[model samples]
Structure formats: structure tokens, C-alpha cells
Target: MTEQPARWTEATVYPDMWADPDDDPRNSEGPSPDGELGSLQDYLTNYRLTLRMKCEGLDAEQLARRSVPPSTMSLLGLVRHLAEVERHWRTWLTEDEPLPKLYGKRDADFDGAVAEPAVVEASFRDLEREQAATDAALAGYADLGERVGKDGVAIRELLVHRIEEYARHCGHADLLRECVDGRVGQ
Candidate 1:
């Protein structure tokens, strides 16, 4: 096992989601950029990393374990679901041609998530790909207020929604991971 720094403690510093900012690998020391878009993207980035961090050091079975009972949600499921969410949002933001969903039916991402090694590997890989693609699509737009598509969705709205979506799921992840192995942190 790796030796942890002595400063690490379970005590909460404040009413923040992160229990220990100094020990958190995902904590950013720099201030948010001087714009709404920058701020939104910054939060989104943190949540994305939080999701990945929550799943760290787990085997395929644990990753896919239905940690939350009575609900098909699993860490692996969240990864797959977020991947599809990213893809769908990218299409909406970029007005790109519609792509078929990762899993055909509703909630299929969670339903299909199983304790298979291959599936766990693929889930993480898909998430990374989808997030990168979505980031690329968002890069094309500078004006957060600019609206796109027939529905006329604002870029800022979508960006904020992405952060909100990840934040909600990351909370779920906190419980799920703790249930699995008592591991908890930022």
C-alpha cells in the first residue's frame, strides 16, 4: 500500500463537497477564469474527474457491482450513461448528425452494465472518448449565450447542465463507492 500524507484527515473543513481540498488530486488551486463559460467548464471538468476518482482502484466486478440496491445503478453504469449523455449533448450542441444511442432502450446503459472485465474496460474507454468529443464540439462555440439547433438551446445552459448532471451523479457515486469498500474523499 502507498503511504498517505500525515495531513490527510476525515474531518470536513467546511460545507464543501470536497472533504480535503489539499489532499484531493482533482482540486484546482487557480481561480475560475474571468467568464461564465470558463467557470462552467471548470466545474464540469472537476465533476468529470470526480466520477473517475470515485471508481479508482476497483476491479471489474467492483466497478460493475450494483452498489445501490433496488436501483440498477453501478459505477460502471454511471460511466456508460455519462458517455451516452456526452454524445447526446454533443449532437445537440454541435447540431451534428444524430448518432444511435450506445444502448438501444431507455436506461439500457445501466441495465447493460455487468460485472464483466471487458465491459468495465469499455465503459471507461467510451467515457473518455465521448467526453473528449464533447469538449471538441464545445470549443467551436465562444459565446455562451449563442443558441443552437431548432430547439434553440443556449451553449451556457448546456454547459451548466453538464456540470449539474455530473455533480448529481457524482454524489450517487460517493454513496456507491462507500458502500462497496468504505472508500471516501473528494
Candidate 2:
């Protein structure tokens, strides 16, 4: 692992502490209107945003740096992988038939992840776009009990799963970001 700077600066500080008011979901003071589903969505959204915040201001090399040796996973790769994941889940939930995978190869996400600025920017953009689409698709369903997904999974289950996925990745992001610059916390 490369040594990180010991001091913190505006560029190295965690962004979540000073995030835009509109994006600060945790600042809200009450239960969500839609109950469990809304809570899950809120958690997922915040976690995803936090992941992005963790990578903010980092250059392509830093973003593409793997925290541990022998692992191809990087922040850029995670963003790309999550974009594909969000698309896959949304398509499965919305359609009656099983849709083909976005990347034909199951490991295409990691395979395509590279240490390039354009690729990193594109991956982040794809993630934001897919996230927006997934949010819109989820907005129409009021009943969390409604069945979605090809295997007849309940909407609530899927929602919870999304939250879990984001939470898990957020942890990874924290470690990766710290490894890059030594900044930590939400």
C-alpha cells in the first residue's frame, strides 16, 4: 500500500460532513412517509451518495487504485458494477420476463475497469443515470408487498436487498478511500 499524507485539507476531507442540504437525507427528523420501503430507499440513496462523496476530488489514479494487492476492485469499478447491478435489478423487477444481462460476461464490470480518467467519469455518470432510472421505476409502486423480480420476490425484499447491497459497498468504499488518502468517517 502507498503511504498517505498525514494531514487533512479541503481536498482530502470527507465531503459528507459538508454535503448539500438537499442531499443530506440524514438531517431529516422523522419517519418516512412510505414506512419501511421509504426508509430502505432513504438508506440506500444516502449510502450510494456517501460512496460517491468518498471518492470526490480524487484523481483517476487514486480512484482506480486498489486498496489491497491482487484485487482488481476499485472505486471506479464499484461504481460501474453498481450501475450494472441497479439496471439488472430494475429490469428484473419491472418486466415479466427475464432480461439478458447488461454485460454478457458476468465479470465484465471488473474486467473493463481500468485506470483511466474518461472511464472513471463515464462509470460515475452511468451510476448516477441508472440510479435515477431505478428511483423513477420504484416510485410507482406503493405497496411494498407487491411482487417484483422474476422469482416472485416481494418489493419489500428487493428494497431491503438494495439497501443491504449499498451498505455493504459503502463499507468497502470507506476502506478504499482511506487507503487512497487516509480520510475516514461518513
Candidate 3:
């Protein structure tokens, strides 16, 4: 019987990861934003890119692979969930009437993350579209201190919260990617 080969990307570099650190695409090199808003945006941008990088070079099945039993936190699910999050935030900030939830209800984003190419492509598209829309909405606010949404949450707080959410999810992405193919890095 023939053994199955590992599902890994080509050009593995280091034990943890093959790609050179300096050449890593996730590096948003150069001076970071000095002001609070710039700083928040920078962090958010990097986290978003990091998540996408982690999911790269993977097929639909790998993207939708669940972490452990009873948990449906797949890479594809994360993308979909974040899309819903971005859409929700943008709606809250821009509209007097909140639009309907993207995935309908809680956890549907994860639950519906089946291993299908169309689904995977749609997840990425939705995430990117929502992220752009959210950023555009954020740009309208000159001051982070200014509040938005029905709950009256400040833009500063919302940006920070989004960064925090991405940070947490990126950590999860690292673990999930490692488990999927033994490839690991920041």
C-alpha cells in the first residue's frame, strides 16, 4: 500500500515556515501610523492580511476542515464570520436601520462552511467586499472619538474591538493551519 503525502505548499523554508521573514508578504513594512486612528487601522489591516495569508495555497477541503470534534471553526468559516462582522459594523455606523444579518443567525457562518470550491471563493469575495465597505464607512468619521451606531459606540472603541477580534482569530488561524499541514509562522 502507498502512503499518502502531506498536503503542503511548495518551497517550504524553515522548520516552522520556509519563506524568508523579510520577504514575507504579511509585513506591511515602513513607518506605521503615528496617530491613534492610523495605528488602529494599521493593526486591523495587518491582521486581515495575516488571516488571508494563512488560508492561502489551501484547497476548499482544507479551508473548511474543522479544528476538533464539536468545533466548526474552519478557516473558511472565519472568513465568512468576519464578513458578517464587517457588514454589521458598517451597517451600524452608516444606517439608521440596521440591515439583516449576513448569515441570518448565530454560528451559521461556521455551520455552512462546507467543503466546496464555490463556497470557498464566495467566502473570500464576501470578506474582501465587506472589509472594503467597512473601511469606507470608517473613513467618513474624521474623529475616532466621535460615536456611531444605536448603542452609541465610539469609532475608537469599535476599531480597537475589530483589531482585537482579528488578533484572536489570527492566533486561531495559526493553530489551524499548523494542524492542517504542519506549516507554521507569524
- Model 2 lDDT, full chain set: 0.75
TM-score of 3: 0.88
Q: Estimated TM-score per prediction? A: 0.85, 0.81, 0.88
lDDT of each residue in 52-160, candidate 3, tens digit only? 8899888999999996557899999999999999888876685488767777788999999999999999888999889998888888898888877777888898899
lDDT of 1 by residue, 101-147 (tens): 98778899999999898988888888999999989988999888899
User: In model 3, what are the clashing residue pairs, if there are any?
Assistant: 13-18, 14-17, 14-18
Clashes of 2: 0
Per-residue lDDT of candidate 2, residues 1-186 (tens digit): 546655343333345343445555455766565867656877887788778788888898888887777887788778888888888778657556645555558777766777898888788888888888888887888898999665777878778878888888888887888778877656
Error of 1 at 112 (Å): 1.4
Model 2 residue 112 distance off true place after TM-score fit, in angstroms: 1.8
lDDT of 3: 0.83
Residue 85 lDDT, candidate 1, scale 0-100: 96
| Top-TM-score structure, candidate number | 3
